[model samples]
Target: MPVSTVSIPVGQWFTDDSGRWWFDSGSLALDFAYTGAIRVTVAPETLHAPDDLTGWMRERFPMPVGVARSRDLFDAVSLRDAIGRLALAAGRGEELRAADIDLVNLYAATPDIPPTLGGGSRQAGRSVQTVGQALSTIARDAVDCFGPANDGRVRICAGGCGIVYLDTSRAASRRWCSMQRCGNRAKVRAHRARKSGKVALTAA
Candidate 1:
């Protein structure tokens, strides 16, 4: 079954140690991947408890999902790690691991929230009622993103943020995850470097 590609809004934010909030990856699966520590070494695990998972789902999905249990948290973290690994491989044009593929397939095979019609208004109907369904939806999106349909559009953030995002730009030249975050930082660093070089030339 072909999963319809869904565009997740760019509202989900993560705060780094410097207290700066960073935008999430554009896709649902990639956003879910952002919940875990991708490449940074310190403070890796973000989904610490069941409530954490519940909070994450509530923030992303339009409707409220049931409270996640311990088992749900465990499974969610496992799926998140698998998606991160597979996404990195897809972005780098490397062969994906069999275990990661099988795990994502297992979750994708589960039932997911379906779009529904109500009150004569068409809603995306992401009314996720359970943790399992939410995970399934994410896994299905991952399959769409990393599968042959992707055409190698996935890319890791060049700014060293370790975010794996689908390159949706027209030119496919996007390097940073968010312009306000990494892009702005890069610009500031370049400016400072130029200023320092000018100072050195004056001293010489």
Candidate 2:
């Protein structure tokens, strides 16, 4: 199974410039990486202000995160980029940069949000005291996913989407990030090409 700090909803989808919905990349770190342009063809800049960061936190985590500050936003963007680069490198079998590794380690060193019980429900939730804690949690998840034992499972979508994801299939043969997004598009294009070729041959 892919490493994750929380349950990934099957319908958790994000829209891009083309209005196509794309799902999570199977981990919180990779999801964060997707909030902005990394290696992906369509980049979405969702973290523009402190409120943007907090809103994203609320969407991703079941618990409430502390109010984000301007400084926190800056740090979050930096960490996000570093995580993105690391994930793409891992997926492409490229060498991980030392600076990016150090940046991730620095954020991961911070204390993470502690789990709390009794939040109007029996389910456990996290108590995030600060934005740094929330970021630390994401950085730690990146560490786990990019580690030697799990890095091999990282894969870049083959449909030219440029997104990276964990290949958790039984045979580890997953080629696209999401079937509804890239996979179906690829199938349609192949079918069109075949039909065009057949028409040309009949005319000739």
RMSD, every candidate, angstroms: 3.4, 3.2
Candidate 1 clashing pairs? none
Tens digits of per-residue lDDT, candidate 2, 44-141, equal 78799999999988777767778899999999999999998888889889999999999988998888776554656655664445788889888888
Candidate with the greatest TM-score versus the true structure: 2
Question: What TM-score does each of the candidates earn?
Answer: 0.80, 0.81
Point out the worst 10-residue segment of candidate 1 by lDDT: 4-13
Candidate lDDT values, in order: 0.78, 0.79
Question: In angstroms, what RMSD does candidate 2 have relative to the true structure?
Answer: 3.2
- Shift in Å, residue 103, candidate 1: 1.1
TM-score of 1: 0.80
Question: Residue 161 in model 1: shift from native, Å?
Answer: 3.2
- Candidate 2 residue 23 Cα shift, in angstroms, is 1.5
